[model samples]
Every structure is written in C-alpha cells, then in structure tokens.
Target: MFHPDRPGPTRTNLAIRTDPDQPSDTDPPSDPDRPSDPDPPSVVMRTDPDRPNEDLIKYGWPEDIWFHVDKLSSAHVYLRLPKGKSIEDIPPEVLVDCAQLVKNNSIQGCKMNNINVVYTPWANLKKTGDMDVGQIGFFRQKEVKVVAVEKKVNEVVNRLEKTKVERFPDLAAEKESRDREERNEKKAQLQDQKKKEKEEQRMRKEMEELKSYTALMKGENMTTNEVRTQNINQYILINN
Candidate 1:
C-alpha cells in the first residue's frame, strides 16, 4: 500500500545520494564545438514546482546521472552535469526523478516497471508555453526499460456502478432524439434557402433577356417608320 503520510522503501524522497559510477563534479566533460557551456544540466518541468516533497526533481554530479523506474510512470527526470562533465556524466538522480514521478502519479499499490530512459543534449529540451509558477525541466541518460506492474481495477468497477445508479437512461434517449430532429430540420432549411436563391436568380435572368428583346424590336420599328416618311415626301415632290 502506498501511503501519502508514510514514506516507504518504494517511496524515496529527493534527498541527495552518491553513485560510484558517476563522474567527478569538479571535472565534467565539455564540448569544444559549441561556444556556450557544452554541459548544461537536464531538468524535468512540472506545472507545480512548490509542490513540497515528492519526485519534483533530482540533480547531482554529472557522473551520477540517473532516472527512476523506466516506462512505468509519468516521471519527469533530468540531469544537470557540470560544464566540464562529459555527455556520459549525466547524474543518477535523473533516473530517480523519473521513477519517483511514475510512482507518485500511478494508481496506488500498482508498480510500473521496464520504463525507457534516454539522454539528449541539454539544449535539446525545449519549453514552449508559460509554466505555472513552480514548474521546471530535467535531463536523463539515454537508457530506459519497460517494467510491468499490477494495476488495481476495483476503483474502475466502483465508478461504473456509481454511474449506473445515477443514470437517467430515458431522459438521455429523449435528448438524443430531440438533437437528431433539430439537425435534420437545420439541414432542410439550408437546402430550401439554396433552392430559393437559385429560383430568384433564374427569374432575374429571364426578366433581363425579355427587356433586351423588347428594346431591339422597338428600335427596328422606329427605323422602318422613318424610311416610310422619307418615301412619302419624295413622291409628293415628284407629283407636284
């Protein structure tokens, strides 16, 4: 049983620990090609940083870089190596942070195992959005594994039972039917609007064509009347 009040063997707090395989803090590796400090430390960012006592973050000597249980939980772990520490010198606390986060967030009593742990250049970690007041980031080594743990299913069943008790099946069905009817009505209205617009456009075009034809006939009639008048005047002049 994982208890919040009591810290168990599985629940390790963020007290600093030493790992023999880690590099010396004084002489961390540095990259010559990069102008900025080559060995930036890895960090795990969380929405809440002031969240007292949990897996929050783990930082240690470059050689001691570590992460928590691999692939089991949502643990944000990272390493902060000295500028002089080699790429391999990420601290063991990196893994520890990752593991602690997994343990903290997982269903109580279930164990997450075989999670993956990996490392990237500190520069690779990016933060896109504004973090809430206490959030931070981390770095971990390029080593990780997937670990399996038993999960508790009782809570899930209990929730389902509660939902069944509170459900209003009849009311829900009525609402669904009403919603479907409304959608159909809206679709029919849109179709009707389109048909109306097309009919109006057709009528306008027919009206315009009729007007043009009438104007052309009137112009022809006017020209014929003028020719008749000219012939009449010429005949009278000839007869006189």
Candidate 2:
C-alpha cells in the first residue's frame, strides 16, 4: 500500500517499506493493515544482497540513518526519517523493524542468534576512493549506535516485506536537485531578510526626519514678528 515516490534517490532495485503504524511524538499508533499516509516514514534496503549499491552510500540524504549487521555481511538498510526527526528520535518499533530487515537480508545473520546491529546517521558515514565498493568508515565512531537483536521477529519482517516496493532512481541527479533547491531556498530567505531590514531602516529614518521637522516648526522654536517688534521697542527704550 506504500508508494515508492519520494525526494531522495538510490540505485536500481532499491527496496522501500512504508510503515503506517509508525508512531510519532504527536500522533498515536495506527492500524498496520491500513494504507500508509502521505510522507510516512520508510525503510530502504538493497534488493540484491550480493551486490552493494555504491550510490546508496554516496548519495544518501542527511535524513537517512544507515543500518548494518555488526561484523557481518548484511544488506545495507536505511531509515528515511521525516523532516525534523533525528536518529535518536526513531521510535522503538521502527528501530526493530530496520534491524530485523537487515538481519533478514543477511545470509549469516538470518541463521544466527543474538546478533548485533550497528546504525548511525548517514552524515557520519565516511567513504574513501581507496575503499572497495560499498565499504564505508565513520567520521565519528561515537555517533554510531548498537542494538542487540536476540532473535528474528517473523511478524515484523513479514509486515515489512509485505509493504516492500522496488524502484530505480537516478541517485546523482536527485542529490544534485535537492542540493540546488536547498541553496536556492536559503538564498531567497536571505534576500527576504535583507529586504525586510532595509524597509525597517527606511521607516526609522522617516520617523526621525518627521520628528526633527516637527521640532523645527514648533512655536517655541520660531520667533514671531510680534516678539521681534517687542524686542526692538525694548532695545530703543533701554537706549533712550
């Protein structure tokens, strides 16, 4: 029931799963069988376990949280968080879902018990030209987190698999487009801010000029003709 259309892109045969029941800080849990809402949280993975997609590592968005089996070969799983949500904000159920998906896709992980899964924000992922395809290092090891999966949960895996959808996306193009849009949006915001400040400054200057003009035109500030005549008469009397 979940569609594969979204902004971020990955390589060919990317598996995406939408969870309608994904809980948020503001919303309650929904029925899993119900259709997914627009822009629902999703989990992404590679369909081919043997071949890891380099585009996924290279072009992943900042919102993506990467997941893999610790010290084992597993499909690279990513959780595409909603806007304003961080990796720490991931709900417990959703975390388990991602962990299970990674475990399920891994040949050795699926057969083992008490496996460990490591995850971190995509921004922490560090890739080098010397590294082999899909190989990645972390910029900060402290940002990485580990979760223990005691055993595979068939219900969760089944639910996710049922909603899995595949799509081929141009990763490079999508990333470039997203970056360009962000830059343009920031530029527009800065322009608007500058315009607003200029307008405010203009109003302040007009207010100051009006105040000065009013002070200059005040009766106390200008000598009247009658006062001038009185002053001359007083001067003549004093001279006489």
Candidate 3:
C-alpha cells in the first residue's frame, strides 16, 4: 500500500508514495549526467502484482514516467513528475529510488544483479485491445530508457515504504475532468489572443486615421480652420 496526500486535480486508485529521502550509503553513486534536485516534490506510484489495475495505463497523464523490470514480470511503477518538468529532468536519486522499488517488487529481479530497468514517458505507452490485462507496449521503442540496477538498496526502499498509504481514487473521472479543464483553458487562451489582436488592429486603424488628420492640419495642407474641420469631418464620414 502506498499513499501520500498531495493536492492536485487528478488522482488515481494506485499505491502512491511521495518525496523519498536522499540516497544513503547502500545506494549507488549518483549519475554525473543527471542533475540532483535538493527539494524534489514528486510522487512515486506502483500497482499490485496480485491485483493488476489497467486504469493506470488508461488514465496516465503526460507528466508520468513509467518504470518496470526489463524482460520480467514486475510491478508497474510510475513517477508522477511536477508541472513543467519532463522525463529528462528526473533527478538521478529519484531514478534510483524508482528503479530500486521496481526491482524489489519483482520476484526474480529482486534476486538478480546488473539487471536493467526500462522506463519511458507515459505518453509513449501504447495499449491495444489485443494485449492482456495490465500489459502495454511502446509507440516509439527508442524513447525507452534503460537503467542498470546492480542490487536492491534497502535504505531507499525503507524510506519509501514509510510513506505508503492505500487510496482508491476515480482515475477515469479525474482524467476526464482534467482533459476538460485543459481544453477549456486552451480555448480561453485562444479567445484572449484573438481579442488582443482585434484590439491591436483597432488601435492601428485609429492611429492611421489620426495621422491622416494631422497631415491634413499641417500648415502647407490646411489654408484655414474651416478647411481643417471639413477635412476631419470628411475623414470621419469616410471611415464610418
């Protein structure tokens, strides 16, 4: 059971743990390429092997990163990244935590050494009706990343275990609601942009008309005040 209370629009009925502690002595050295986050507030999610949940596949958000033991039946672990973050932005320590959790959940993987863990963004997950329950494929195989897990890190597992809580959220409804909100937001943004463009066009037309009136009122163009007034009236009439 994994659960952590993090306020958000979408929630799922999967076991969730949040914000694992930093790596301890048992963990492997951090990757030099990946940056470390000092204050990571991300959520780790996993499905029960005994009771597979397909909703995870169906309702996964774009921000989700999926993890599993390579060529082995293991729990489907997911890392829900924060807004504005991508799969590449996942910290090295967090990657270790997820890989360790997935490895430990596997009956065979837990005992193996130097085995690889495959992960990819949730958007790349491919589901077909022909596939069995709780099974998924990838749209772009190249997008999947592999992480080598030499052994299980008990310290990281223990830290993540402390945050476990069981909660059954309505994954479908949440996804639908989130999708609706996003559509509405995009629609609003488009409307705002159109409104702004129309205002800009109106302003430009006004400025052009004012420039024309100023040109007409110039000493060389205007012989008298009456002529200037006449030109202004004629300009307004033409525009109207």
Best by TM-score: 2
Give a tens-digit lDDT track for model 2, residues 15-106: 55555466434333445555555555655665455566778878888888988888887777888887678988887767888899888978
Candidate 1 lDDT over residue span 180-219, tens digit each: 7778999999999999999999999999999999999999
How displaced is residue 234 in candidate 2, in Å?
Answer: 4.6
TM-score of 2: 0.79
Could you list the CA RMSD of all candidates, in the order they appear? Answer: 21.5, 7.3, 10.8
In model 2, the clashing pairs are none
Candidate 1: lDDT of 91? Answer: 40
lDDT-superior candidate, 1 or 2: 2
For candidate 3, which ten residues in a row score worst on lDDT? 1-10
Clashes of each: 58, 0, 3
Candidates in order have lDDT scores of 0.40, 0.76, 0.75
